[model samples]
Target: MTDNALAYRRSHAFRTAVTDIGGHQRFTRAYRPQTNGKAERFNRTLAEEWAYAQPFTNSHERTAALPGFLHNYNHHRAHSALNGQPPITRLNNFAGH
Candidate 1:
């Protein structure tokens, strides 16, 4: 309803999808990537390592491979900030620890 909310609805697929699934919509200010710094960094890493490291033969092949890359990134890769734990592990025990 606000300008920022309308902007989010127009811009981001994940936000739009979540809203469609009965989630409430809110908006963070523009130019405030620090608010979601971890996700922003992960996205940069994904783009650098997986998406644009080399030329994809086609868009379909790139799209098809993204889930596997994401799975490995979340489940296997150690993050220094997490004290060397993978994201999946951290997520599973997030509140407990």
Candidate 2:
């Protein structure tokens, strides 16, 4: 989901791209602050923990590291908001877990 930005809400190209990828854009609710705040926090954490955690020799190296980083982030890293549990712990009856 995106914030209530005019570019995301009004840009024809953006909408077309989302549709082309079999997805659609949804905006955060204006009345619920936490929805947007959570997304912003995740972005900050992703940048801090993965994107800038180390120097890569090249873009390819960084790109190659993303899957591992995401696995660790979602399945291993403890989040304060989740009561010190990893994100995966919050799932209810996950298919294979």
Candidate 3:
């Protein structure tokens, strides 16, 4: 699956990875937001809660902070749909314990 980012959509590396993985080349609907609803929602949450929560002087600082934000989001934040478990817990198959 791919987002609408121009760089991601057009990058040689991204295309090569998808092809190597046996994925077909298809584009998400241009104007239909529902086509990628899950990703859209995640992007919204990330932007509101992490990306735009504070002012960064430059892109470098924001990029540097992304790993910490992702780590915390995956390991600390609880999801109601996941029965209050962290994403990493589910991904690592340790949610029930």
Each model's RMSD to truth, in Å?
5.4, 3.2, 5.5
Candidate 1 deviant stretches above 4 angstroms: 1-5, 10-33, 93-97
* lDDT by residue for model 3 (38-90), tens: 66777887898778989999989988888788877778888886899777786
* Model 1 whole-model lDDT (C-alpha atoms): 0.71
The most accurate candidate by TM-score is: 2
Model 1 Cα lDDT, one tens digit per residue, 1-97: 2224455667778577767856666554566666456556766898997899778999998888887887777788788988988777756465533
> Model 3's lDDT to the true fold?
0.77
- Which 10-residue window of candidate 3 scores lowest in summed lDDT? 88-97
Q: State the lDDT of candidate 2 residue by residue for 1-97, as single tens digits.
A: 7888899999999999979967789889998889999879878877887788899899899888888987888888888888987888878965534
The true-structure Cα RMSD of candidate 1 reads 5.4
TM-scores of the candidates are 0.62, 0.69, 0.63
Number of the candidate with higher TM-score, 1 or 2 = 2
Error of 1 at 45 (Å): 0.6
Ranking by TM-score: 2, 3, 1
Query: What is the Cα-based lDDT of residue 21 in candidate 1?
Result: 59
Candidate 2 deviant stretches above 4 angstroms: 6-26, 95-97
> Whole-model Cα lDDT per candidate?
0.71, 0.84, 0.77
